[model samples]
Target: MLKDVPRSTSFGHSSSVGTMELIRPRASKSNAIRIRRSGFQDFRRVGRRENDPRYYRFTLKRSGRIDISVQNREFGGFLGFPTPTLKVRLERSNGKVLNRRTVRGGEFGFISRRLDRNTTYYIRISSSGESVPYRLGLRTRGGAELFR
Candidate 1:
C-alpha cells in the first residue's frame, strides 16, 4: 500500500529524468526555487498572469562555474499554436543581469559564468508572447570543496 505524504513535508522531494532531477518546492514570496549543488532541470509554464516571470536561486558551495540552459518545451508548437519565444536571464542576488538570451521554440539558450563561493545567484525565465511551457537546466562544474 502507498502512504500519503503531506504537502508541507514534501520539501526536497524530486523525481528523476536521465541524470537530472526535477525539484518541486512550495511557492515562496518571490516564487524562487532553490537549486541544489547536484543541479536540477525543471519544467515550468510561464508568461500567463501570476507566473509571467519564474525565478530560481542557488548559492555556490565554493568557487565554481555555473551553466544554465532554457528551451521551449512545446516543440513544433502545441496543437495549432506556434511555439513561444523564451527569454532567459542570469542575475546576481542584487538583481543585476549578467547575461540574457532569447531562444525560440525547439532551440536552447545557455549562459555560463564563474561564480564565487557562498554567493547567491538567480535565473529568470519569461515568455515573449503567450504562456508556454519550458525546461530550465542548471549545472555546476569544478570546486568540490565546501566552504567552512
Candidate 2:
C-alpha cells in the first residue's frame, strides 16, 4: 500500500544544483510542509559529477520486510570523485528519531538498513534538505517498476 507521509513542506533558497528537497504526501493540505532550502554554493568538490537513478518512497504502517539501498556512479576516476556524499535519515511524527546515517560518498551499494513497517516515516536527504533542483526517487520492492 502507498500513502503520503508528511503533512506539508517548503524549500528555502537554492544557491546551486545541489538540490535540497523534502519528501511527503500532498493529501495533507490541511497543514503546510516545513523545509530549509538554504546554504548552497558552487564550491566545486574534487570528485566529478555522476548520474544516478532516483528514488521514490511510500510511507504506510505495516509489519513486513523492508530494506534501503543506494548506488554510486564513477567515471574513470575523473576529478578524483570515486564516490558521492549522502545523508539518510528516518523520523516519525512529533519529531522522534528512529534512525539516522550518513553516506560519505559511494556509488552503488545496499543500505543494509531495515525499516519498521508499523510506524510513521519521513525521509530527508542530507545533501539538499528539501531544496530545489535536488533529485529523489525509489523503486518497487520487486525492482520491476520505478516511482517518483
Candidate 3:
C-alpha cells in the first residue's frame, strides 16, 4: 500500500519529491550543508509561523491501525543538545481526535484503530511557543511506511 502525504506548498510546487528540514535560522547554514550532503531532494523551513502548528496530512491506504512516530532532529545530533517536549495530536479529517500526547527523550508511537481506508488523518506537531525541527513517520499494520 502506498501512503499519500500532502506536501507543503511553501516549497513553491504542488508536487515535488523531497525531504523537509524544519530548522532554526541560526542552524540553517550548517543544516543546509548536511541536508545537501545527505542527498535529500529539497529542504523547507517550517516553524516560521509563531502560532500556526505544522500539519502533515496523509491517507492510510489499508484499514486497520497506523503506528505513528516522531523524531526531533535538532534535539539529538552531533551536538547532543537537550531534547524538547514535543506534542503530537492525531485526528481525523472531520476534527475527531484519535490520540494526543507529549513526547520527549524517546521515540513516541501511537496506534490508531478502526480507521477507514483512503480516509485522511492528520498529525499535528508543535512545541510550546517554540520552533522545533522534527521528522514524522507512519507505518500501517500491513507494512506500508511513510516517512518525512
Candidate 4:
C-alpha cells in the first residue's frame, strides 16, 4: 500500500530574494535626555555658558510624590569665594513651570511635587554663572516608579 500511494511534488523552485532595510525611530527634536532611573545623577559640568540650562526628561511608572534635590559642587569654598547659585525648575512636557528653586553651592534645593503616573516631566537646571558641577537627587514616595 505504501509503494502504491501517490506523492505530490512542486514543479517550481522557491527562492527568497529581496532587499531589506532596517529603519530606526528618529530621536526627539528636543534636547532633553531621558532619565532611566531615580537616584543621584551627577553632572560633572553644566551651564558652560551663562544662562544656559540643561534639561532632563523622565516618566513616572506610578502615581506618587517626587522629591528632587539639586546641589552645586563648591570647589571655591576653601578660597572664600561666593558659592554659585543654581536654578532648578520642574516643568511639564509642554514647558509649563510647576516649581522652581534656587540653591547655592554646597546646599541642596529641594522641590516636592505630586505627579501622575505615565506622565512626562522635565527638570531644568541652570547655573547663575559660568560652568558648575552638580549633583541631582531624585526620590519618590507612594510606590511611584522612577528610573528603570
Evaluation by TM-score, superior candidate among 1 and 4: 1
Report the lDDT tens digits of candidate 1 across residue range 30-118: 76877875558899888754376778888777887888888787578668777779888888888888999998888888898888887
Q: Against the true structure, what is every candidate's RMSD?
A: 12.1, 14.7, 15.0, 19.4
Best-fitting candidate, scored by TM-score: 1
Give lDDT for model 4: 0.75
Give lDDT tens digits, candidate 4, residues 3-103: 23333347555544454434323223176777877674756556653225777788888988888888888556567768777888999888889999988
Task: Put the candidates in TM-score order, highest first.
Answer: 1, 4, 3, 2
Prediction 1 TM-score vs. true: 0.70
In candidate 3 the C-alpha lDDT for residue 38 amounts to 12
Question: Could you tell me the lDDT of residue 81 within candidate 3?
Answer: 61
Candidate 2 or 3, higher lDDT? 3
Off by over 4 Å in 2: 1-57, 73-84, 109-118, 128-148
Checking candidate 4 for backbone clashes, the offending pairs are 36-147, 36-148, 37-147, 37-148
User: Candidate 4 regions off by >4 Å?
Assistant: 1-29, 49-51, 77-81
Model 4 TM-score on a 0 to 1 scale: 0.70
Cα RMSD, model 4: 19.4
Off by over 4 Å in 3: 1-51, 74-83, 105-114, 143-148
Which tens-of-lDDT digit does each residue in 29-131 have in candidate 3?
1122211111122212234443236566666455565666666454453376665566778777787888887766445545445566667667676665455
